[model samples]
Target: MEELICMDRSQRLFEDSRKVLVGGVNSPVRAMKPYPFFVERAEGCRLYDADGRSYIDYCLGYGPLILGHANPAVVDAVAAQLEKGTLYGAPTELEIDFARKIAKHVPSAEMVRFVNTGTEATMGAIRLARGVTGKNRFVKFEGAFHGAHDYVLVKAGSGATTQGVPNSAGIPADTTKNTILAPFNDEEAIERIVEEEDDLACIILEPIIGNIGCVMPKPGYLRFLRKITKEHEVLLIFDEVITGFRLGLGGAQGYYGVKPDITTLGKILGGGLPIGCIASTRDVMEHMAPVGEVYQAGTFNGNPLSMTAGLAAIGELERPGVYEALEKTGGYMRKGLRDISEDLGIDTRVYGVASMYQMYFTGEEVTDYQSALRADKELFLRYQQELLKKGVFLPPSQYECNFISTAHREEDIERTLVEMESALRTVL
Candidate 1:
């Protein structure tokens, strides 16, 4: 790998930013060692840093850029909407059209309400669950990040059945008291928790665990969850913020053939813009404000600009062979990574659904968070640095999933594989 030049401009910018902004970044993950690179602009699958270093961005704006950065259709749509207005603080025909599109694609999204972000979507879903069921307690899998809200901030204790410990500061103990934690892909543990816990409102999780290196659910695991949730009369909520439009227009529920009572979507739905939605059957959705007593409102929710972008994005996804192309591209990358690891005698597992992947430096099958932790962080860090120097960019953290966008061409994957092979050789 070639020696990389110093990000002098980015370093100076970070220094100046630290004087005003906390940790010199809005998001904590952006505070990388030696200062994270500041982006000057991004188009398609590439990102240009402040220091003029261009990287093949697999981060894809943390998985929202499914159609890739500055997609022409989406850009044009938003630009057109901008001429009309940005926000009305009221309803528009575009919102109705967007919601209908969501309902048409997502199996469980019979009715939909747009929100601003994934955090807001999950938080609102939780409130709806509690209100409808008249139950305070809810169940979430360990390592499954629904959002950064008080209820979801609790971490699993020593055991799966035990109450969660508050993982973040400023979160009240009482707020998370009803938040039960269980292991991902462990059907027995979830069943046990649901059976024992009284007045449980919902079982919420990402169908495919995206937080801990894209750990997939075991076969029949989601089906089991759906059955148990139904039998127990608990609302099953699939937090498809990452999987929603990416998995397919139908999301994970459509792919796995397990319909949840409610689904929260973000990421690809916004076409790289800020947006989110909580969808459910009319029976449950009727309970939310203007129709029922359960109150939920957002000033910027369903804003026109986001609505226009989302329409264009979903429209693009509706085109034939879009997902098929993603699968082919993702498979090419996955196979190349695995073959390289095998050739180098490295214990790496490249795993994920189509268009999303993560490589864990462990030979063992990663079924849950505990198993995922076995990945070698030190080796991953070194490999990541080497890959960056070779002009390939991955997510800074090993725990995060690497995304592939429609913008990634054949040559991009081939180039990435070459850099990855070199990076692995260095680490080994």
Candidate 2:
């Protein structure tokens, strides 16, 4: 395995890096079996490794690069803003602009506060919910990731779920004891839990789950959730870090036509920069700091670089027909992959909504994490290696979603399909 030419350099890097970095990678999922390939550069939909091998990148930084790498607009915006300044503890107009832009694009958004990561956004939202409702307990779904925070880390101890005990060693049991867990698509579990736990302050979910592969809420599941949360005096929060601009200008809420009381956005919000935000109605948002009690602050909360990149990225996403193009591209990819698997007699199921899709290497419906776990991991591993060999790069983790950027054209799409056919043949 180490002798493989295409992956040898990556394997070497992992070995060298392990002495200094945990698992030889900054992030766990990036620690693939053959070691993660160290990217030298990326352009459009392609990534070039240190070994000088180019591959069509499907990981897209785990669903953030909806516009692809170094998009001229986003890059130029970040670069230009850097000349002005990097960070200032003081607030800037760019902050207001970005917030206004986000609120304008997302209907459910009336007021917004910026943070540095998705974890922070969710953390802030949870506190705000507790502050606003005067309740402590909350409801979270199984296998839905809300960043590496403590409270939302229940049943989610998947990627960073240290020991698969909901909360890691550092987090006391009391933190998650109130954090009730329910399976995705099981509204009954949620309703029953809400009925039992009258103190439940909020209910948060990914809407279209991406942590454990892309799983859409079944039928009126979201509507039912919204109803339950509202009826129970609980705030419904949508963790849209992945779904944000990737689904549409309004994210999953707009895509599904259901509104959550609060939405935490990350990934695409700052183009490729690290940023996250929590947006809610005026009444709900006012509960933070100056206006109320709950406090959330960051020195780089609205750094100029991220603000500019976000402005450009959101502008592009808000462009008319942008989502339509995404729908077409995502649909094409889903069909192409399904056809390839069927031709190779490989069992597979594609689940997701809008531009997001998940491919499970089993001929069964994957509605939740339990069902997704039934997939053929060995086949997925072989598929990953085969695709990499064919100059295509996908997220190594079977539990993550690979994205399709607008930069992908018919030609790029066709090449991916060709590689898929060849890779499927090799794996099967």
Candidate 3:
């Protein structure tokens, strides 16, 4: 049987979930149109949904599950940690070890402070920048989402940043008063902003710009930002939440060979658990409390459960050929997609670095948010829904990037292409 009534079963669950949940989900991204599937379990590259439908999972928990879902190493590590404890509401050796691992792997992470999510990491970075520089204003790119926090929300990247504007509803107008927005990949705009707004404490950006559909900086753009920020005495922060440990060992900073004054990390660091970190030189980091006067703390800041998972995840990622394999797979898939799109006579542009990618439904290149926005939203939606129907799950919205994991094989990529060809045929 083809699971003919499976959608009906899924509809009932979503309808029931709505009564108790906001927008029927915890996060807005989870609320895809026609209802998102409630997955029962996941292993390797596949997810088993509540209705017993097996799907090829390209979402990969939005870029964290690089080792893939329920890998034995990750599960064993978590299981072992369970014997010790969960949340101590205090510090542990695991946190220190994990921090050390991050410092060793990530080139710019000299000193790190942990938080629960990428949102907190970027939010704290902004606050700390203001505290250190004694300035109120900041600058962010048009489509680089740092998090849901009010200060960096404007011209927000990803979900909020994708549709347009800063905050959806919860933020006050005064929150974004000091936050200035500029077009990504435009060196002149940033140069002008620093010249005009002398009070800018920091300039933060995603080196690879994953949220705005996996766009990359134009040639020398990242280096230009670094040079401009240094000349202005403004701190440069790389919001590598999605890029950290995914693109390469040291992240986009390492991959692009451009170093920023500060870097925020999440996603891969936690191994699919909740964790984020902001790091910089010791002098700037000393400004935080216990070292200097800037105050920041968390009750569950370095939970052992997440720390153990993180430690294990980072260790496993260190294995030789891990990233190389991911890149190879990513390259294979990208080529397959490009070939298919070309065959279908669909105008498309695929942009990326390493395992992260986005397919823009336009012939034009996407060097920044403005160019990324030129992609076809209607076609993207139709394609996404069609792919889902064909048992392959891409990011629900066109704004998010498609992530590849080490678990994905050549067969998986070919299978995805097969499904993509079918979907393209329908959509075109």
Candidate 4:
């Protein structure tokens, strides 16, 4: 067995935190077994914990730090914005600049409305869809997490799945009754739902299901959705919070060559800051606010800091070879992990695309949430802990996808593979 890394300071902090914080962490997924390590600071692709232990971070702040932590461009932009002011509750030129950039890159973003988080972005998108179509029902795939909103919590992935509560207790039955759940990669299920439910407002989904350990869409699946949703007179909304800039500047919509009626972007769009946006065609977006009756507003929406950071972060992404480099590294990592599992004769399924990946302990392919649920969660957690001992930090959940950043160099990837192999050996 590998010797556990010392986390005495972090252990003490967790004890103190538990008295005041829920589950000793703000987010449920941060609740790692044997207590989570409290990060003191992060730079590039590494996290320095309270115990002074450094780890190569694949969590990447849950998919926001694509350019990596404490990026100079983002830091400088935010710093400059701080000198000017923080929040104005009023419009700024920076917001316009950021929105313009989003429209330039994202295929579906001709107009935009900024919000505070991915949750807010999705909530607004769903509401807008309902208002536009004057319909009550919407379709979401099983184990696909849009956010922690009441409407989409029925079969959520991420922390909800990790905590063994896909359906939370507080939500009323009426809220979820209208939410129809379908299995991913299944066209027949969607066809039935569309035919049966006459008042369907929209079909919202993550193009690549990142919440359920990065499941890719089957061939023609996205195109199938675009066609069917159009035929049914239902709007198509793409929740690209994780995949927005992570896949490429165009996000999953561009990568798959299928555009949606509405797109929700967060995470990387904020550049490690709090930001989310619901974007669509000018005609659709005009339906929001003073322009139209679908009301959505926030004090922090289009706040200067997030706008500045987003602009700067995206500007960096606009540089040549960024996506190519990320693709190459991602491919390398996936191949290496698959090879290690094969070499060890371990029963595992490696899944990923671009800079996202995960290894399910089950031998079968993970094409949907049901298959993903069959993977040995306890075994995956054991492997995660083992990797932590070797200075590698994953998200600490089998259901959450691991990420790679531009800050991750060749040496980082090589060392991670070595550690991963050792961790797999120790656990399996």
Cα lDDT of model 1 by residue, 147-256, tens digit: 76788876521111111232777877888788888888887798798889888999999998887778898899999999999999999999999999888889889989
TM-score of each: 0.95, 0.95, 0.97, 0.98
For residue 145, give model 4's deviation from the true position in Å: 0.6
Candidate 1, overall lDDT?
A: 0.86
lDDT of 2 by residue, 1-428 (tens): 54654546767777789999997888777777666788889999999997899999888988888889999988888888888889888889999989989888887899999999999999999999999999999888878888888887766724653223545568888778878788889977986898888788899899888888788788999999988888878899999999888788888898889999999999999889999999999999999988889998888888888888889988788778888998999899898888877777777898765667778888778888778778886787788888888899988767888788888897888998998888777777
Task: Score each candidate by Cα lDDT.
Answer: 0.86, 0.84, 0.86, 0.94
Q: What lDDT tens digits, residue by residue, belong to model 4 across residues 178-216?
A: 899999999999999999999999999999999989899
lDDT of 4: 0.94
Candidate 1 residue runs with Cα over 4 Å from true position:
1-7, 156-166
Q: How large is the C-alpha RMSD of every model relative to the true structure?
A: 3.8, 2.3, 2.2, 2.5
Error of 1 at 66 (Å): 0.6
Pairing residues by index, what is the TM-score of model 1? 0.95
Worst 10 residues of 1 by lDDT: 157-166
